[model samples]
Target: MGALARHWTRIAVTLIPLLIALLHASGALPLAALDRLDNVLYDARLRATMPRTMDERIVIVDIDEKSLAEVGRWPWGRNRMAELTDELFDRQQVALAGFDVVFAEPDDSSGLKRLRALAQGELKDAPGFAGRIDQLAGSLDYDAVFARSLQKKPAVLGYYFSSDRGGGTSGVLTEPVMKREDLRGRPIRFTAWNGYGSNIEPIAKAAPMAGFFNPIIDVDGVVRAVPLLAEYGDQYYESLSLAMFRMLVGLPTVEPGFPRDRFLGRGYQGLESVVLRLGQKTMGIPVDDRVSALVPFRGPGGVSGGSFRYVSAGDLVARRLPPGSLKGKIVLVGTTAPGLQDLRSTPMSETYPGVETHANMISGLLDNRLAVRPDYAIGYDVVVLLLAGLVLAFALPLLTAPKAVAVSLGVLAAVVGLNLWLFLGAGLVMPLAAALSMVLTAFALNMSYGYFIESRSKRELANLFGTYVPPELVDEMVKDPDSYSMTATNKELTVMFCDMRGFTKMSEKMEPVQLQELLNAVFNRLTDIIRDNRGTIDKYMGDCVMAFWGAPVETSEHAHLAVKSSMEMADAVRKINEEHREKGLPEIGVGIGLNTGMMCVGDMGSQVRRSYTVIGDAVNLGSRLEGLSKAYGVDIVVSESTRQLAKDFAWQELDRVRVKGKEQAVAIFWPVAPADRLEKPQQDELKTWAALLKAYRAQDWDNCEVLLLNLQRMNPKKFLYELYNERVASMKLLPFDPAWDGATNFETK
Candidate 1:
């Protein structure tokens, strides 16, 4: 409940199914599928617990293929049926008999009507024809013959009710089991029909005790239950099974049974059961909201099925069975012949015989084992679902993984177990599909929400980082997907430009494929070093590979990383040069530049082609520094801004120069080595070089020459000092400039 207040969105999502199930249960928005699922669940439970043992007390007299073959096709004259009835009662001594077949029209197969018509029309002049027809009239009336056989017998005839007839009815309907006055104006809704197909007047009047044999077909067209009582023209009628059971128990009159506890109060639409009244004794036959009872099928149907014994009508009519063979047995006479069309699709079997359903019901009524979806079933479903739904909705978010699983499983088990207990222990058929579905659905949704929220973001970020950085940096870079995108923006970032030298000369000596392979190899080594330090590769252009930092993801040590990768890349080229000497390949030289400044870093280009790259003056200056590296005879050059930010390395001030596009001269430096790794001799050489630049810039020719001599002696291989020495010597012969700022200016890129 508290989860609904706090995590209302997730709670609301889980409640959608619950709300639909509730609506279905309340009859406001009926879900035919839900009812079908309930039937499926019931069928599963029924099949698992079926006794599979034969019921000796109840038997089915099947009018099957063998019977049809032996005694002609069905409607074998009502005179033959009268013989079969007499054999069941007088010879077989069955306790009660019920017909599952309807006799809506007279049995005219005897051809007596045709003979009388011929006598009145064409044969009227033949005096013997009329006289002979009158003589055979008493013996030829098949319906009257069958009716006489039913009189004074414990026989219950069968009929069917229908709603598609448009009030068109045939034959005569039996008296009501209970009248409208018996309900006392409670407005109880019974299964009502518009028309019926009952027995002819003679047979119906002979055996007035009758019931409709219409099993209640659910929306999915499966016979799960049968209405024990139905309504027709303000009169309630009993079912075949109920009628047979009532006659077996001394023909009790039926009364309406009302439940004392209908929680819905005035909204209750049906009775709990039909009360059977006999003297002061009354027995309650439980019914569902439709005044129906679920058939407690013992096992499968048909004669081969072990649920009930089957006696063939042909064998019984031909006296194949000995006298008293079915003594004291309650028999249901129904046909299984293909022509009869009595087969129905039941939960147990698709081609189940219709008569066995009533037999199962009769057996249930005998043992009081009829299962019913009670009048309070909807109320029960709502209460159970609300409790279970509330628990899962509120508890799942609060519990840990194992505890949540345990709680959900416990609730599911409780709901299923309770439902099964009602089915197997007490004979009750209640709604379970909705409750179980709600629990499983709610649990699944709640558990997935917690599990996928973080993982989903991590997965997306991993894809973004997959190509930008090395495999090792991906885990750390998975921060927020919303934090970065291809959208262009301005931020202070560090950009580096690395260019390969002597590439044109090397290509002249080697084949095109060989040159391509060599260039790729050199760039691969450098790119690995850059990505190793959290740098995003911008693009590879010719022999140069550009990279930057603080994008897609941010890092404060962007300049430090840029310088570090630059030094590492220079060393890697030296190793490749060593390999080149050993393998008889051309040596490769690298020049790298590093600068730190505010720049726009994002995906920017034409709509047809785009890239995640950087643009601005800082980037342009970094490129110029790469070009100046060859002029100054150095492998790596860094801008003053970068040197300030990256204080970990020993710096050598190279120059203050203006590139083609810039007016302001930015100071540049060379990273000699790590500050702690520089030796005393190297330190002295750097100081002497700094002094040489100071004297040269001040126009002290003698001091500059003296300082250059000392710097060359300290590091004779250093080209920067030699270059400055040449400049000083050339300036000695010319007039010294009064406005020189000691800044070199480059006229072209």
Candidate 2:
């Protein structure tokens, strides 16, 4: 958890996709890819669940190739259309017959206009041709004949609406299903058109009911839906399917329906359903946000699809069917001839019949089945994204690798399953693309954060500090590895510089390999001592080993640990010398120096070699102290800084000397042993040594000689007492100087 707390940046990255998706969902920004994917998903789902069974209520009267062959090609005079209508109503007795074609131009195949013109002109002066032409004009006028056949019949005509710049002028259109005032002056975004191609005036007045045959083509050129009601000028009109249904059920008046909200009065228009009001009773048809209905496709189109019973218009017109064979069936007169240019791309088929689109809508309307993409779909998308996205972001971090993957998959499944359930069951086509994309992207980001960022950080820390500390300490650092790096920093730490004394003479007595083995053996023991005290070994220079404490890992007992490690290393070297004596090899000497102060410690070097070592004046002093150790006849030399912090060990102050590269003299000391281990005689020797040092600094030659005689008499074998006696005898030759602070100075390292 602590490791996770430090990486807020990685956590924030996982939620970025969700934020973008939310912005898209809320309409602040829109993404085209998401919308396209949503359309693809919707198309797939729609195709998977389509009912292939036929709709028995609707039948298509196809003007197919056979019909065009038998009836002698298209635009076969209006008189032939009149005959087909007669066969459908008078003989077959269909409950309703709708023409999916428009008579936008007058039928002039009978030559009645030419004959009448001739009779009124030159022929009226010559013979009785005017009277003769009047007798044949009744049967020759094909438009009048077709119009008379459709008068007061159960029929509705299909026209087309266009968006052409040149407005319609060749036909007559019916009144709109509803007017703008019906919507209470609220602006609606209905699919609008500027022009139309309707039937001629004679046929239009005769039928007195018509609707446009236009399906809404999406950007991909597939007709997925149809606007049940659309706008033209300031009025709203209904599609052919809607008009046919209205005519079938007593012609209900259309009125716009809105969601009940007080905001409606404040100019917020949210059209929910289209209401067909009949007196006190009303029926509502659900529509999408654009006042459109999804085309509930029954199956693939064409006569082979079996979605609707297909009857060739030629057979129906030629009286081939037995009388009343199609009694009470709703007949839709449309052409399936390819040259007619009525084929459309739909979800079920690429060459779907334009007319059957209306047939399906009618069937769906009859069964009250529609899938609506509601206005609240954006809200649904945003909610699902938040839920699934947040789950992956916060939960994946706490889980192990396997669990994180499992949890992410589980979240994705839940999101997809719920979306599909709503779509298939409740007829709600909500936005699933944004939610699914957000979930999947968030999961990917989280896994990448762990694999690429956090895990990589752990590996880097292990590689950098692994050799400095023990494995256990390395493991602890890896948890929050960002806290440690190779960058140099200033820290208060204890630095140790232990050099092998008499290494030059020792190396001259052996060959290279043997000498290397001896040196490695000595360093192995010293390294073991330093590591045992939890100190970091900085580097090894020839026979000398440098180390430090409280770096890469920190502790308040750095000084004490360094002092303890130095004594252990000195003892281990002596033990190694004991084995050397038995092996007939030269005995090696070890001199160690320890100091504690603020110093720069970390990985520092050029490109070729990098080392985690300390650098500062204090570290230099520690090195100088190591050289002074042999001169003082002691095994370990510690500065006053280290001696003050490490109080567990008994200390003997050696001298106050100004070493090379330093102006002020610093006190130096030697760690004898634990204070409890010092005997009374050793204590008396140290007291005598202190008195001798005080008398020597006072320039009292007689007192110094007397004290040194007593200290040397106590332990004449001690080199420290003999060296101080030499120092006292040599100082007697120099005259007393008042400027001196009773400290010795060394000019060479």
Candidate 3:
């Protein structure tokens, strides 16, 4: 229960954005940016899924520049419009035609009205003028001529819905697709308009069907959908595309398609689709909440696109079209000329002919392949968001950073892939913007916590072990803090002790501050050398310093590091002396001792103050070795155990002596140059010295003396050889014992 509670808490923190996105999807809260992003995704889906090939069933009768030139510009006389219509049906045998333009006023370009007035006034008495004018009146009435051509023809007239402009209704509107009485008891909201522009009364009466061509332009001015049904004064009207499709299928009646749950519950009254019913055949046309159907573009764009064939309007009017060219096809009359301003921004094209939009919609409806955002879209988004968020929130805390990143990436890919699959396979327009945003946002939040909080944890661990471990080892310790600590543990390690020689006498001669400064300078240089070789400083006891390795973090080369630090420390003292000599101060020297063995290492001391240090017999022997360095006339002396571990360094046997406090004998060696850099003379000298030790250990006094004399002559300044010679002389005075061994026992520390 506690784990679940903790998981829930973390999930809640990261799920804040998911909650907001859910609310936005549910319409409880609206986000403009998300809405715009959804539109962009919708556009991309349309472009990706479009057929991008010529439909060949629908053709555009375009009023191009060539058409305008041949027909003498736009607003051509109605007599010319009659000729175009007559030529299409009579000569081209087009099955159906729809206009993307409207004529709101009568065309009197034939001068018939003026001639009638002249007949009634000035030309009333002209010879045979009244009779001739009456005879030609019928032919001169261009509005009547156009209306006669459209009478009883399978032609749908187009119009526009005017909104935000007050009190402007032009021409005459056709019979509404559905009357207010048709849906008297049903609850439905249609897109309403204040006024409209329609064809003149004569044209409206003569056309077989009429529908508006006004599209539902989004806030970004991109036409993504068209209202299949619009309302004016509680009367629903059909769109041009919807009207053409209905006429094709024997004029099916339009009805609202609302979804219900449990057959009895009016759970959601929102419109889901627009249904067309002809006898028993039913077709459901998907619509959005606003009763608009998504525009199904067949290709890339309207004009340049190859979705529909375009024929110049002037060709039709001039009878230049081949017989049956538009036969058995749906013809839409529109213009692509830039001056006509029929171009619109659509999902498929920025500058598209308005007529092609209707063609695409008609094709989509006939094929029933329109992409629909189902009513359960919001529910799906919420479910996906919560599932992804919960999984990330719970799993991120338990896994390491790398594993958490892997899981997040997997979830992200699954989410995106599923969305695209639904879009392509099911023709379902699901909401991806919210789901994708939630996934990325949650992953970012999880990773940010690890980066910031773990960084602070690394700092804390560094502070805890910084003084007792190298910086590099401290970093390793922080990587797994639970397994590392300051508690004492017994482990085989190497410890080193270094002290300045003659420091007491030097301090007695100098002032207190001067002595302190000199000690600080010497200790700083020595400590830097120790750290450089991966040694940890244990403490600074006045002029002496203690350090160790293979603690807090394990290393296999602890002895090697200690010996290396010791050698570097000896060389560093020489550099310090050079600096002191340049400054007219007394030069200083140091003695270093290294020993390797099992020891208890960790924080040790009183409660008032404690320190991370080592304690055991090995640690005591290391101190004894440092004190023995002076007696051997050398800078560094290491125990046999340390010497065995550090085989890469050159060594010279110092003595076989047991320091005070212990009776067991142990061998000590002085570290020389690195083995790789040792000179041949030094190698030869070591070989001769080894033979001398063997002779001395065997009680052969004469051979030992002779070997020592030769070594002294070869390396005259070697005080260690003189000490061994003195030992040989002292042993010669004592009577030889058969059980005696060459082990010198020191009685002082």
Q: What TM-score, over all chains together, does every model reach?
A: 0.65, 0.62, 0.73
Q: Write the per-residue lDDT of candidate 3 for residues 410-479, one digit (tens) a residue.
A: 9888887888899888777888888777778877876776666667877887777787677777767778
The lDDT per prediction is 0.86, 0.87, 0.86
Best by TM-score: 3
Query: Candidate 1 regions off by >4 Å?
Result: 1-9, 114-135, 262-267, 456-749
- Give a tens-digit lDDT track for model 1, residues 379-438: 889888888988887778777779999999999999999989987888778899889888
lDDT tens digits, residue span 360-476, model 2: 999999998888887667667877888888877778777777998899889989988998899889888888889888888888887887777655766677678767776666766
Q: List the residue pairs that clash in candidate 1.
A: none
Q: What's the residue-level lDDT of 480 in candidate 2?
A: 72
Q: How should the candidates be ordered by lDDT, best one leading?
A: 2, 1, 3
lDDT of 3: 0.86
**TM match of model 1 to true structure:** 0.65
Instruction: Report the CA-based lDDT of candidate 1 relative to the real structure.
Output: 0.86
